[model samples]
Target: MEDNGNSTACCVKLADALMSMACMDLQLQSSIHLCASDNRLVPGKPLSPGSTIISDDGTFALGFFSPSNPKKHYYVGIWYNNIPKFTVVWVANRAAPITVPSSAVFTLTRSSNLTLSDGNGHVLWTTMAKSRISISSPRNTKNISTEAMLDNTGNLILRSLADNAIIWQSFDHPTDTLLPGMNLRLSHNTHPLQRLISWKDIRDPSPGPFSYGADPNNLLQRFIWHGSVPHRRSPVWNNYLLIGKYMNNLNSTIYMAINHDSDEVYMSFGMPTGPFSVLIRMKITYLGKSNISAWTTLYSEPVHDCNIYGYCGPNSYCDNTDAVPACKCLDGFEPREEERRTNNRSFLLGCRRRKALRCHHGNSFLTYPSMKVPDNFIYIHKRSFDECMVECRSNCSCVAYAYSNISSGIIDDTRCLLWTGELIDMEKGTMDGDKEIAVKRLGKGSAQGVVEFKNEMLQEIQRLTGQQGSR
Candidate 1:
């Protein structure tokens, strides 16, 4: 486990001369200076654009790197140093990229502030002192010693020489990826929720529309939002020490945990440390897919396009049990007017009721099994099966109802979810729980010929629904 925000409060004490000693050891062994591996930037020894500082374990590196094309623009960032391919984790000046690489200089000022500036002394980025500390005027403090070091965990920290007082750190300002030992704040009590914003594209490190973080409106659930709309969602957090433990292709287990205390509530996931842990990263790709991958078998969530939020439009259910996941109309429903053509290949417009329900004529519930409940549902509580059924039955506006005793919580043990409007973002075979939904529809007796066709269609639906449940 790791601490939050100011990590030094609980950080393991390391000697101030740790970086010097490490550099000295390397010099003695290799007799190299310019290309030597020294994990710190001491005052007066400004780090140029070409040079880089590697973590003690050499697992990560901090230096200037360019995305898209190396000659175009350069940004100071931390990346996996040992990996064959350049995989950056965090960027210092994301919006501001230095065009001329030769003019870039990363140095520590007399005030112990780490600054990334150009040859003309134009400050691109800086880790300035907090409010309490004063650095109003620059002074030649020959006696003062300050240095910046890259820790083994890939965290870049700037500390004072007298005492290891952490002035700033990279973990406090995360970019896209949530590395191991990273704390993602889930509440705004102490600070705003920490979110992971995806890169604009493979070539651009700028911020994109996709972001993953705690839902402010509802603290219980986490969402992957594309702009303002949710793309994928995680089940409500129940303050579990361990929510899920998934095994990767490399046979390593990744665990997700919900941790909290008096001050903060947050979620973080990590794999086992030591040699067993391989290089892995959880990222939301530019195309809006959340993925967890190691060197081996990494998979993306919402695997099918049908699983995407409302991809099949309103009143349509995505069937993933089939050879190919697709959308289809529910029973007693047909495609909407303009989309009713037999030649229509896409179900983008979805479906509408074949015969509008008449409350006076009486309607019946058509149970659909193995379902991922539709969005925009009202979660009603403390209701039995009969009570839940009546709750929807009494209301003419209620289109569907789903009852489940899925939660162990005291408040909403029996979930009686009711849907009033058009059902969107519905899918089958992807639900963790095999919950069935009963849709309210017009009930009418069919003739002999129509009865045979209806029975056959019902049998096929049951088969597919059964597969969804089993999946």
Candidate 2:
């Protein structure tokens, strides 16, 4: 219960003070320091470079950990407190875990900033922050009353007890996990769009090849990027929601919900109400596939089979419920190679066009439904299905189109995506399932109606003239 500085916040825990005690009461009387975990540090006990300093509220924890070798280097990290089986949501020194024992420590300076330093006082990692109120010359934060905390919602915040203001928070600088209320925004408006980057490997906490972000071009759908290519995609948004299908077997329905506030729009998921509380999370695996898992089940996932992204390659479909192992091409489409061989040993080479299109006035569209549509599409603003059809037919460059009615309050309150060239990584669904797409087939006879009309008119004129047969 003391006011040493003019600031308004209180320091909940001090590493120097806490290290002397085995446990301490978290309830602050006049002191305003407030993180939920009770942690103790000792001079002889340096946390073994692998344990944690958790808050009293069971919200966040600070610990030295490694997903890889037990005897290897250790990274300072923050993770959700209640979730079972350690899920490291944020890492302070992702690229620089401490290799040597007793060589690292986490501290808050006098100016209220958090930094991780090695034995020789070399800063391996630090949080990015700016002062809330400017001082005369930006005073160096020597030992200001600041602390690192993990919140109930899974945000690791670097805050000052002197003023009750957040200097920096992990919500703004996420590594891979995107909780219920976090904004994945533009880096500098000129960078190549910000995204959720996964780990290089399960055991390694470095940046990986897979990243998830909203499509900058349209921002209507979420995309999974591998390098710069479309690795996979979420369902196109409709009214800020995507309710895939009601599964009678699962006995549980899953759907996406979009929320918009003063700054950004974020997406989250929910399940049907039941006796068991179901919590869902999306994790992008090292093998480059996004998986959705439920908290209530032991190991039950709706779509964890073989068909995802382009696992089977282009134009090929994987039938999940088939008796023997299922992967095949559509009726009119043919495999790229005929002698490629059997199911288990062969990969999806995709389907090829049975016949070429003239792109002339004699083409017609063949509707192929029950599909998981292709990638690389641009959305057309506020267009109806019939209008979309006309627009595609009028343009020779356009190859395929898909439509979803979204009241998203963006341009037209409707979503219409178009593709110009190749159809890659598609699949077919069953009559009862919901991964349906309508594939358009443009053939030479596609424009036969207009051609037949013109030919008929020419013949009539020839008959009337009686000598114009050659023309």
Candidate 3:
């Protein structure tokens, strides 16, 4: 509580306190010392008494504080000093709270780990992922870069001058909110992938339902999973061939950007030219929805309806910015039921054509403009628009095809995406994407051929994956 009581102009005193805390633990008595907040965050060991960890901009301070009752217990967390609110992004001791408020000390153990322990010698918190493998800075970084800092991007990092690159960050091990630069990948990197797990309760920082990330099995799309089944799914990347249509919309400009660095690929959206810039964030809601939001003068609404996953039924789409509701059936098709009303409503039983593809004769494609493609598709790289079409059509089972050039300064000039089978969850977009697609329409005969083709193709897929087909 007295950490912030000192004068504003004071310095070096806090630095001294940090160095003094290192003496509490025998293992850290030597290498543990303090570095000022300039380029380096003052550090001793994580929980040494008198030592305080501050963010680079001083927007947040990391130190010991009690969660609710400060007089009886102490917790190590990061919070804002300027606001009337105590916004703790991370808490080092969430499960264990010191009872006696005994003289607490945080030190790097002989095992090369930073740990928080009671003055009576009780370990409460630690930074080691696994206790079996002793923590080591092979380069002896902690002795070099010296301080662990919370950077401006909300990343708490440990760096050494020897290798300035980030060694550890809280982003990689998310507690609740997904911060920028965090890759929520599958722990197994295979089928039955995981998603971003939320917290158990509002205050309790434990894993909850509603994890979000790309579906490894159906990777052309991102999904929010409630345990195992898909709670919600993003517009499948269906050859989402280059949807980069950067337009100068008033002040804030929205452009999709993608890049690769060190074998990791990521994409981020930006509004580079905005006045009094505000936070534009996206999150997988607890109720299972992907929301893209920006801080308006007063309230925030879905920037576009297409932002919601599965707003329209399969082979149908949401066309926001239109006078009517954003739902529209894909071209060359109509709702299957005779009782179908031409209005915006959410329903599955996707559109069916008056012109049935009987697989008896001609097959043609009806092109749609400014459309957010469908889900349940595959990615076929290095294929031209025509090549992609042929790949789907020759199979006879291939139902539809959507191709994007991706050459609009984002992806390969010749990169193509191909789709087969039923088209689901599509919507018309503000931008027509960079190119168009050709959907093959089958006559009654061709339709029958497609059904047979699909059966045989399913067999090959099962064989390839070494899965037994149903008897």
Predicted model with the maximum TM-score = 1
What does the lDDT come to for candidate 2?
0.55
Expressed as tens digits, the lDDT of each residue in 23-44 for candidate 2 is 3342211122223324532222
Leading candidate by lDDT:
1
Tens digits of per-residue lDDT for model 3, 1-471: 222333133122112211322111111111122222332342343445444565554444556655342244556655443332344455667667666543777654544355778878888887773322333443454543334566654566654444565545565655434433444443232324334565444344345576667666643456667777665555544232223333343244444334444534444444454431223334544455544444221112234444455656666666665766556666667776732764436545666665655452267555554455666666677876557656776666666666543322334444445566667666555532312345667443344434443344334334423421221
Off by over 4 Å in 3: 1-52, 63-110, 116-125, 129-146, 160-166, 178-196, 200-202, 217-220, 235-256, 267-308, 321-328, 331-344, 407-413, 431-435, 442-471
User: What are the candidates' C-alpha RMSDs?
Assistant: 9.7, 13.6, 11.8
lDDT by residue (111-199, candidate 1, tens digit) is 77788898787998888765223333334445545668998887888876667788888887888877777777877475777888888
Model 2, residue 266: distance off in Å is: 4.0
Q: TM-score for model 2?
A: 0.69
Query: Model 2 misses residue 434 by how many Å?
Result: 5.0
What stretches of model 1 exceed 4 Å from their correct place?
1-36, 42-44, 110-112, 128-147, 158-167, 220-223, 229-248, 272-278, 342-345, 357-367, 379-395, 401-417, 431-438, 441-471
Worst 10 residues of 2 by lDDT: 1-10
Considering lDDT, which of the candidate structures 1 and 2 is the better prediction for this target?
1
Candidate 3 local lDDT, residue 172: 61
Which pairs of residues clash in candidate 1, taking residues 3 or more apart in a chain or in different chains?
A: none
- Measured with C-alpha atoms, the lDDT of residue 17 in candidate 1 is 23
